[model samples]
Target: MSGFGNGRDIISYVALGDSFTEGMNDPYAESTGTGQERYRGWADRLAEHLARTCGEVRYANLAVRGKLIREIVQRQVPRAVELAPDLVTLCAGGNDIIRPGGDPDATARIFEAAVRRLAATGSRIVVFTGMDTGFQPVMRHLRGKIATYNMHLRAVADEHGCDVVDLWSMRVLQDRRAWSGDRLHLSAEGHRRIALRVCELLDACPPADWRDPWPAEEPLPWRAARQDDLHWAREFLVPWIGRRLTGRSSGDGRTAKRPELERLEPARYRN
Candidate 1:
């Protein structure tokens, strides 16, 4: 708001990160879309909220799936600085922190450096801490590392006077339904909740409450849960490991979906 040279209006915004920001697994309602329009994650949802609230908002998302923190810093951060938008939201380093022998300290150093660069532009910067992974079977063991990195992240935000979206404390995300089938990226409901949370951090009136309670449902039987886990490992986890072994990324040869900031049109906003 203040950084936008206007009172309570973010005229322009740029998003930087990985699959989360890119809107993976959150496809458009009309069709299983392709290319730039395929996903509409939290950043896009936040932009929609801004357009509805602030009027004529310009938004850009320079995020790709499977991108590491270093890649984001090397590729997206410089471009974002050049754009010099009124606001920037970054949520990188998750890919790095989840890898084999990943060091949260090293990741935080790179993350902080990126934050410093963005802070210099006088734009309102918002950074996200990793979510509580204790609910995730595959990622639960790395909770300590994520928590360590989050501490450093908070310190970095404090040092730079940036707002922080502390996702670790977002109890809504711990719900199993908040995640996608692959169990890495968030589900559509998850993205919606995150968008609302980000809007709160930005001091904007979100379209709805992020704290809305999920409907109660019966838990899956023991055998069903085990079968689901096995299926997940076969379909998602194995392919992911294969990619790592072959040095391939889901984002290979991919570029930013919205590389340049553009006006957010009401007609383009999807539910």
Candidate 2:
């Protein structure tokens, strides 16, 4: 256990990273909106759980979609330090690692600097490992790179006394249903599961178990699987590639959803 929620009061919390931490593809129940309003990923879910347990928690999420590790460290890390929160979660570097010619070692060095800086603030820090991409189609080829990065992350956590949410080992996320239509971002259910996992790590009472088995489903036929892949390539992969080639990011004009640490009104956010 990280001793996060173990009798200690977390008055303020900040999350920093990329789309994963930004809560992409997981929209709020009542809103089918776009941009900041539409996404409510795991970090938001974790914040809600914390508010329920600790009360009047100040929360800020400084994660934007399509950000790389250097961008996060250079931009969000300073803002987080200024906030001086009691708890912080950092989940960056996936975008960097997945890109062509991306170096895990170089990324780790940058990541370590950020972690070291945040650790200096005496906040309880949580870092996430990249999920095993072995279950993914084209992404499976990068499994070794991701694994190398995960190892580096574990070392960083050990060195900094940070708690790690080991996504690679979380078998629940291996299911195809856990991912969104793009197969890049997580589904709403996936975000929920992550929240439960974080709650467990922090020793807070999760509404349900993260390990609860998903309902069984029949396998897709071979032709259907191929069709789905083709659709994904057309709808998601190609555009993503074009963006990279043209130096246009999905988050080019976007800012963090919750940029400042503000008191969370449970009634306003809770489901």
Model 1 lDDT, residue 185, Cα: 86
Clash tally, candidates in order: 0, 0
Cα lDDT of model 2 by residue, 1-271, tens digit: 4444544454799999999989988988775455336689999999887777674689999999999999999999999988889899999999999998999999999999999999999888999999999988789999999999999999999999999999999999998888999999999999999999998888877789989888999999999999998999999999999998897888898888899998887776763
Where does candidate 2 stray beyond 4 Å? Answer: 1-10, 31-37
What 10-residue stretch in candidate 2 is worst by lDDT? Answer: 1-10
- Check candidate 1 and list the clashing pairs: none
TM-score of each: 0.94, 0.94
Instruction: Tell me how candidate 1 scores on lDDT.
Output: 0.89
TM-score of 2: 0.94
